[model samples]
Target chain A: MRSKIGLLVVFTIIFIIPTLNYAFAAGDEPGEYLDRRVVIWNLFFRMMVVAFTIGAVVSGTMVWLVWRFRESNPNAKPTKYEETGEW
Target chain B: MSEHGNWAEWVYIGVVCALLVWVGAEAWNVERLVEHVPADAEVIKVTGQQWFWSFEHEDGTKEIGELHVEKGKAYKFEVTSKDVIHSFNIHDYVVLIDAVPGRINIVWFVPDEVGEHEIQCREYCGLLHYNMRAKLYVEEST
Candidate 1:
């Protein structure tokens, strides 16, 4: 249990902290392309980055789950049928 | 669904809560001009008709189809409509305001680029909505 907490803290410091900083830095870099000098552009760029990151993670997880439970794998068998009795 | 899943569940909830806080903070800080408009900001009165846009400057100058503004200067647009509701939209600047009859909507923008930008009606006001268009000319400030 202590090891798990330690791993979470290390993961956050090494990965999550850098990701947060990079996200903020990414927002400032798109000002050159925006037409108006508005802060909304920076926020918009940041939103898009976060949204895309979430979408990629969700889609990747879905793909992995589908592949893991595919019919091709002999170990991936169906659990119980709702219509019939125990088999 | 396991007996020893409390820690993992708590971690998931914590992460979700953090993400929510981050999103809420970003939204709360979104740039919006509610009041205290700069005194030196150029005021442009925009009146939208069924198929045309009219611009009026503080100097009593009227311009149709094209509006000229100085680059690097702040501008506040007092937008309204003559007959129906129309959306005054400048795609490049990401400025959009509803021009409703009997009410004035105010939106502001600072032009940082000098060029001709296309303006169009984003709302379907009438049959000739497709023809309702204008141009914005941003010139270098003197």
Candidate 2:
């Protein structure tokens, strides 16, 4: 479930959002070319979304990892690599 | 780790890397397209003084606190500074470029809307930096 959610985050941030941004840009009616208002505005918004998305995902992952693997976690299980120092 | 799990991890990494590479290429292309100035773009010389912005048109007309441009026409601003480093910004049009001493920086934009906009120096130059502002008039073409 965790990995699935992480993958979903990655896919949305890396793929879906940018594709939507382009779709909106491509739909513009022909009149002005290279309007900085649109270009810079879109770029700023897309980057802001990507940055916040990535930051949230990474922070969530770190929090989850800490909560699941901390020394106080009762459900923590030692894997083969952790037990015998070999994988 | 199990062999299948190891393979899955590797494949996942490979897919992510491929997607990242694709995104990077797309961003590079878009940046180039945005910064590319066409041959017919009108050039306007922009000088960044210590406390004000100045513009010079091709016809030798000059303005200190105001710039008039035609709507729908692409304009290329060749920016430079006289005393210190400054940043030229037309916030309404999102045209921002560094005005460095001894070097000319370039930024271009097409004014789609005909109206009054704001232009300001984004860098700290002197005591009067806060008052360094101008009006951008995008007049309709005759």
Give me the candidate number with maximum TM-score: 1
Flag clash pairs in model 1: none
Candidate 1 deviant stretches above 4 angstroms: A1-38, A80-87, B1-10, B32-36
Task: Kindly report the fnat of each predicted structure, to 2 decimals.
Answer: 0.20, 0.34
lDDT of 2 by residue, A1-87 (tens): 999999999999999999778755652332336765776567668767867886798799999999999978999877757777876
lDDT score of residue A49 within candidate 1: 95
Q: lDDT tens string, model 1, B1-142?
A: 3245588779888988998889866765453222235556788999999899999998999999999998878788999999999999998888899999999998777788799999999999879999899999999999
Clashing pairs in 2: none
Top model number, lDDT: 2
Per-residue lDDT tens digits for candidate 1, residues A1-87, read: 999999999999999999777555543321222234356677778989988998899899999988898889777876565346545
Give the alpha carbon lDDT tens digit for every residue of B57-131 in model 2: 988999999999999898889999999999999988888998999999988888888899989989989899998
Q: What is the C-alpha lDDT of each candidate?
A: 0.81, 0.84
Report per-candidate DockQ: 0.14, 0.18
Q: What C-alpha lDDT, on a 0 to 100 scale, does residue A47 get in candidate 1? A: 84
Those runs of model 2 whose alpha carbons end farther than 4 Å from true positions after fitting are A1-32, A71-87, B1-16
Residue B128's C-alpha lDDT in candidate 1? 95
Clashes of each: 0, 0
